[model samples]
Target: MPDDFSWSDFIQRALPLAILGLALIGAPLLIFEPEGLPRMRSLSKELAQVRAENAELTRDVSKLRAEVRELRDDPAAVERIARGKLGLVRKSEVVFQFGKPR
Candidate 1:
């Protein structure tokens, strides 16, 4: 048994260094590892963006479904799209010509 260095003193001195070494190892794992905290945060942001995009796509699908239903079931809907988008007119309708100013 050593006179100056006891078991209690060795434990006290080595405990803080051991803890610090563990903390140093753990910090790199937390910040830089592939499946670490930083990756989890990145995945969280990606998940939010995907959710928002999914919501927007859902809304667009709903709108398209409604438009499809209207165009399929309503003659007026077809006529409105034709007249507005295709510049179509019936045989008996008068046509007007407008010119842009130079």
Candidate 2:
């Protein structure tokens, strides 16, 4: 409507506004529509589960390493494992088997 109005000037102003509008709309669409918050939460939960499992395995490995050292160096440790896990006894030891009463 104004004399200064031309297609180039109109396009210059309208193009930036259009791009800004699309950015405003598309930013939220990128975050909240399909693969955003929910995916992040799922990944976070999986990471936590993996970290917890890794910590548990680390503790188990440490215990196993200590047990291995003990078994290698201490004859008493070997006997304890043999007696507890394999139900072994010396030839002179007496055996006792107690059953639960119903």
State TM-scores per candidate: 0.66, 0.73
Instruction: Find the number of clashing residue pairs for candidate 1.
Output: 0
| Candidate 2 wrongly placed segments (more than 4 Å) | 1-3, 6-8, 91-102
| lDDT measured at residue 92 in model 1 versus the true structure, 0 to 100 | 100
- On lDDT, the leading prediction is 1
lDDT of 2 by residue, 68-94 (tens): 999999999999989999989999999
lDDT of each: 0.95, 0.93
lDDT of 1 by residue, 1-100 (tens): 6679788889999999999999999998778888887789999999999999999999999999999999999999999999999999999999989999
Candidate 2, residue 1: Cα displacement in angstroms equals: 6.7
Candidate with best TM-score: 2
Full-model lDDT, candidate 1 = 0.95
